[model samples]
Target: MILTFCNQKGGVGKSTTLYHLARAAVASGRRVLVVDADPQGNTTEALTVDVPSDAAGVADALSDASTDTLRDVLVEGVWDGLTVAPTVGEALNAVRDEIANSHRPGWESRLRRQLEGLKDEYDLVLIDSGPALDTLSTNAFTASDGVLIVTQSTKWSLDGLALLLRTVDEVRRYYNPTLEVAGIVLNQHEALTSGGKHYAGELEAAASENSLRLLTPYIPKRAPIKDAVDFSRGLDEGDYKARPLGKLYSALLEQIMEGTGR
Candidate 1:
């Protein structure tokens, strides 16, 4: 399955969620490929070490019309069973420009077609998109089988989700007709507080209104998650896997696996 972790608003944990999902997938004995379509390259940075300065990556593949295969840009073994097609921060803007200006036959569906060629090699493909509705983000939606919408338990987050869902609807209508929204992942959750409860209720209403499942076991605001991102380390390592947050992610992984049947 090709899944894109997306949200228009930043700090909604899109990159973090993708990173964890990749780790979880690897732990579950799946071969995973991650596409870092986000210009921020947070996913690329977190999962890999010593990214070569001269490597031709996802941005290069998207921006260059001559690029034919994803394997030319793939970085092998970023983790045990994880491979990455990384982005160089500034190069994605060029990809956006190419997609906008190129009057080509398959510009929008380029990523999808490329991944289709390698479908047999990976059990799951995860795309981490930028926190905006840009060309690269559109490419991600077009390329994905399903989308995992990440949001916080807040009103502003709901507004972003509305915009993102509209984009998803357009993509389904005009691009990938079978594109499914897997569910909404409420991240950095703090449901015990008064404001948290209020926003949680709001999220529940929004999900029901949109006919999206509110994915179970919301991820709480925790220090280890922050530290894992900050330290560029993984939480499923060593004793951390036994922590509450790790167990939470394990459950999240199980839910995702059940959805995808992986």
Candidate 2:
């Protein structure tokens, strides 16, 4: 299945969630491909080791003037069962601008076309999108089978959730009819804090209002989770403190698989 882990708000741990989820998928022996559609390249940096600065990437695949296909930019991931279509600095941003200003037709479907021939190569494709509902995000939405919305349990994040859902509705209506909301993941939650609890309740109400599923066991604010991504290691590969978080991601992945019929 092709899933885009998206949120229009930055610092919500979107990339980190996708990175760990990809690791969990790899640990389960599934072949996974991570498409780093974000201009920031956080996912690419997490998944690859010692990549060259000028490596061809998703921007090359999406660029009208470039001959590189998605396959051409795929690099070996840290895990054996994983691969990545990485993005370098400023390239994706430039492509986004080009796409936004272009007079060409079907600008939104460029990433979808790029993924068509490559979908069968991996069991799962996870796209880490930029923190905006702009042209690049439109391409990600157009290309994806479903979207996994990631957000923090905070007032600002909750406010952004409404706009994000509206954008998803628009994408579904115009670009990809079969696209669905895989689920909403509440990342970096502080379960004991009053503020976290209050916002989480609001989030639940928002999900219910929109008929969306709020994934269980909200990801906590933990040092180990951050460390795992920073060290370029899977949570399961980390010390005892990180193993439980790996299990949480594994459960979330299972829920996603079941929802998407994978």
Candidate 3:
């Protein structure tokens, strides 16, 4: 299962979702691969166990198309079951040159094709996308079997979702027909303030009104989320268990696996 956590909008917790799921999946005795397609490298920084240069990272992987090749230098996880294809800061800029001269319509499909050759070695593959609707994300959609979109419950976010869903539909029709929008996750949910409950309620009402069937599981802001990130502890670690965000992520993971069979 290649699940891409995506949203063109930044600060919607794409990297957080990817890392949590990947970390949890590994703890559950699954061989997981993480493809960090973002230029920010937040996922890489959070998960890095070793230092690998950008020149020797993605460019080489795309150039060789070899599954067995040692592409990403940072390799971690229990028994080496978690593999990471983290983007170096250098690869992001260089890819522009490569993509410009490339001839394919969806030049982004390179990552997809690469993962196709490597799918059997792992039980799940998670991709963290950048904050744009560029060719990279198009390629991510092409390579992925499903997408898990994270968004806060807000009017502007609700509006932006229409465009995202349209893009997902187009990608399905043209590139990967089996690609599914497995779930829409509500992040930063809290019922403390009237405004909070109102906004979340409005979102839930809109989803039902539109027959969207958005996932019931949700995530909330918690101190440990920041603490975990700052301390470099993956969600599978016990450091996060006492926080609300930890339980929320655990429920979200269960909901995703049940909904998408991840």
Candidate 4:
């Protein structure tokens, strides 16, 4: 299954969800390939060892066979059946320009083509998209079998969900018609305060109060979540502290294994 974690806004746990989910899927014994579609390279750095000088991850992977291919570099190992088609810093803005030039409507199919080439090689392919509805997000969504839309429980964030739903709807109708809106997950939920608890409660309450299907048992705000990995830190120590993130993601994975039940 190809699952894209997307949102059109930043600071809403898009990368975090991708990181934890992909790692959790790996820990769970699934061969997963991660596509880091964002230019920020957050997912790429988190997963990879060191960076090259040029850092044209997507360009090297897609446009040329001689350049260091993302598939060859990342997919060389079978870690718990997980692989990655990672992105490096400064990926082709050319993709944006090319999409603009092509009057054809298959821009979203690019990732699909790449994945089809590697389909027989893995069990699941996960695409971690940027927090915007750009060409990258389009590729991730169109290439995916379903999407896991993440949002912090806030009025503004909730408002943005409408636009995401619309975009996925278009992908379903036109691009990848089989793309399913798997479910919505509420992240960083906190029941400690009235405001925090209220937002969390509203999402939990949404199912009974409306037609919307909300994923059960939302992910709460854990302190380690916002902390970036200290690359200089000892590898073993870093692994120990990051356990909470893994556990949280494993729980989310378990819940996702359960359907909407509508």
- lDDT per residue for candidate 1 within 119-170, as digits (tens), equals 6899989999999898888899999889999998877887777788999999
Q: How do the residues 1-262 of candidate 4 rate in per-residue lDDT, one tens digit apiece?
A: 7788888888888777776666666777777787877767777767665556464566455442335545564632223455556666565455555665666656667777767777667666778888778777887788888888888787677677767888988888888888886777788776676877677666556544544557755777865655533242111224566665556667777676555221
- Residue-by-residue lDDT tens digits, candidate 2, 162-233: 789889999999999999999999999998999999999999998999899999868999999999999999
Q: Which regions of candidate 4 deviate over 4 angstroms?
A: 60-81, 204-213, 228-245, 258-262
Compared with the true structure, all predictions reach lDDT values of 0.83, 0.93, 0.71, 0.68
Per-candidate Cα RMSD to the true structure, in Å, reads 1.7, 0.7, 3.0, 3.8
lDDT of 4: 0.68
lDDT by residue for model 3 over 1-262, one digit each (tens)? 8888888888877787777767667766788888877878788777775555633554456542334333443366322468877677666645645665777675767777677667888898888888777777887889998988877766556667778878889999998899988788887666686766777888787667755657766677665665676566754464535444565666767777887765
What TM-score against the true fold does each predicted structure earn?
0.94, 0.99, 0.86, 0.83
Candidate 2 ranges beyond 4 A from true positions: none
Off by over 4 Å in 3: 63-74, 77-80, 209-213, 239-244
Whichever of 1 and 2 has more lDDT, that candidate is: 2
Between the candidate structures 1 and 2, which one is better when assessed by TM-score?
2
Evaluated against the true structure, the overall lDDT of model 2 is 0.93
